[model samples]
Target: MKILLIEDDLDLGNGVRIALADHGFDVVWVRQQEDALRQLDTGACELVLLDLGLPDGDGMRILVRLRHERQNLPVIILSARDALEDRLRGLDGGADDYLVKPFVLAELLSRVKALARRSYGFDGDMLEVRGLTLHVPTRRVMIGERTVELTASEYALLKLLMVRADRVVTRRLLEDEALPGAHENASNALDVHMGNLRRKIGEGFVRTVRGVGYVVDTAAPYKVGE
Candidate 1:
């Protein structure tokens, strides 16, 4: 999953960004409202974690604009405003969920799962492709009764392929989403991760299209000839 984090505090933003990344989310962090808008313009983020305060402008204004621009965007307010009115107003202003600062990371992750289910029908904490079961929250992958251990990069690549199962995921898309901030060495790095994941799972699990990208068949045993 990809998330847009629009928090201004350096410490808080960096912490949240790392936490989200550890949980398998490709996070794009922006402190100012303009940068947030620019990030949103790419239409790459699946969910948003918006703060109510920013240096350039009020995050509420950005929220208003975001709602107007992308009506169906799932936005969760992550702010220090904990009053009843503040929460109520944020909800009324098209926010899917609200989380006050000083909140538990687990709770925030849970809410993110809930919103993801509500928006995209993504299974909460679990994604299954054929017999391969991936527990998102725990970062565990299971094949039948056996647990498959995978490196972080390998897991990210597998997740990206399984999430878009049956569709052709381009190389550029994979680099940008699955291996964010590593474009300098992404070409060879992704190949290594992909090979590792395929070996751990099954070679037939992920189908590689020549000159394109990888794909997975969630509906059945993924066969290259099929």
Candidate 2:
């Protein structure tokens, strides 16, 4: 998952960034609201951790602007304001979750996971497509009684495809999700990964769209070629 953290406190920001990164999340930290807005414009972040106080402007204003522009992007308020009215205002202004200052990192991480699951329309950490099961939090894949081990990159790629199962996921989207902050490689690299993934998961699990990209056919049973 990719997260944009808009925080001004160097110590707190670094700590949060490190913790989230350790949990397999790509985090981009920006101390200023302008930088946060710029990152949003790139359409790279899956979630936003916004502080109510920013160097350039109020963080709430950024949240309002984001909702005004892209209403679907999940925004979680991370601020020191613990007042009831403050929490109410944040939610009313389109913040998905509110975290008061001096919160535990575990709680913050949990909230992030919850928000991500909600955004993806997942009922829990486990993602089910046909008979294949992917445990998002544990990064485990189960095909019937057999367990499949996957590298981080492979897991990332599979997760992206599985989340958007039955829909065509373009190579550009997969590349962005798999490798954030890196130059895009040729399509052949993705093809190689997909090839390996299909072999491990089962042949015909992921269908290629020729010139388009790939899609996980959740409605179809896994079938090896004739």
Candidate 3:
């Protein structure tokens, strides 16, 4: 999914951009409020990660303006201000989530996912593609009436692919987002985990894109062994 990241700090903005990209999100980063508003006018981004402090303006105004124009667009406030009043103001000003500075990237990613699930109208805790069901909270996978037990890495990999079914999830994105530390040292951890997941879930559900990555096609017919 595409995200508009409005951050003025060079270090934080770059870090967030790289992290989001690694997690398979297309990010359009702007350091100023005007640029952010202009980007919003284009209606290109699906989500917005906003910073309250900007060079030209306060982000709260942007949030207010955005709410007036696009009430349904999802916005997450990323700011250094941590006072209770500020938090309440942001939440009440149409921000979906407010994350303070010096926060963990993993937590930010989790919030982003949660907000995306809500905004995209996903079935709360469940993510289903074809007959494969993934229980998000318990981390359970079910194919038909049988349960499928997967390793931690395998589950992460499969969950990401399934959540983005029909989209080509890149190798870099899969390694960085799913495998994490295992992807380092140029190891075949992603391949190994993917192979295991395919074996457990049956083949043909996931198709390889040669050197690029993998895609899970929900519409394609999945025969037992073709």
Candidate 4:
């Protein structure tokens, strides 16, 4: 799962990022509210860990704007404000969960897992389209009897495409969510990973829309003969 972390605390952010990554989560950490809002626009993150305090703007504003825009997106407010009113406002403002700062990482992870399970839906965290099965908790992808081992980038890309199955996911959105900061590496980095993904999972599942982007067709056959 990909999580967007909007936090300004250097030490805490780093710790959270490392912890999430260690547990097989793709995390995009941004300190500034502007950057966080930009990332949110990309629709890359499945969950958000929003800090109520930010350097550029109030985190509440971001949360408010997010609720206005993406109503169903899961948001967990990580704030030092533990007052009843603050928690009430956060929940009333569409945040799925809230965690007070100086809390244990284990607790945070627990909340994240619980939210992911509830929000992502059914089959115990499995996302299935045709014969492709992506196990969210384990970060495992399988086709028929074969287990496909994917790199972090590959897995991220596949998850995004699958989550938005049958919908055209633009190239820019894919990069922002899956590749993160990989745009600087190579112009065709997305293509390379995508090509590998198609080969591993077999053909006809992911289709290119020429100048547009890619889509995972739920009705497409598992594998088309060469």
TM-score quality measure for candidate 1: 0.64
Candidate 2 residue lDDT tens string, 29-108: 99998898899987767789999988789998898899988898889899999999999999999999999999899899
TM-score pick, better of 2 and 3? 2
TM-scores for the candidates = 0.64, 0.75, 0.57, 0.73
Q: How well does candidate 3 score on lDDT at residue 22?
A: 73
Please state every model's RMSD to the true fold in angstroms: 5.0, 4.3, 9.6, 4.8
Q: Candidate 3: where is the Cα deviation over 4 Å? A: 121-226
lDDT of 3 by residue, 2-30 (tens): 68999999999999898877766668999
Order of quality (lDDT): 4, 3, 2, 1
Model 4 C-alpha lDDT per residue in residues 123-226, reported as the tens digit of each score: 22678888889987798899977899999999989888887676688988888768877666658989999999998999878999899899988786555673
lDDT of 1: 0.82
State the displacement of the C-alpha of residue 226, model 3, in Å, after optimal TM-score superposition: 32
Badly placed stretches (over 4 Å) of model 4 are: 121-130, 134-140, 148-156, 163-168, 175-204, 207-212, 217-226
Q: What is the lDDT of candidate 3?
A: 0.84
The residue pairs in collision within model 1 are none
**Which candidate's TM-score is highest?**
2
With candidate 4 superimposed using the best TM-score fit, by how many Å does residue 3's alpha carbon deviate from the native? 1.4
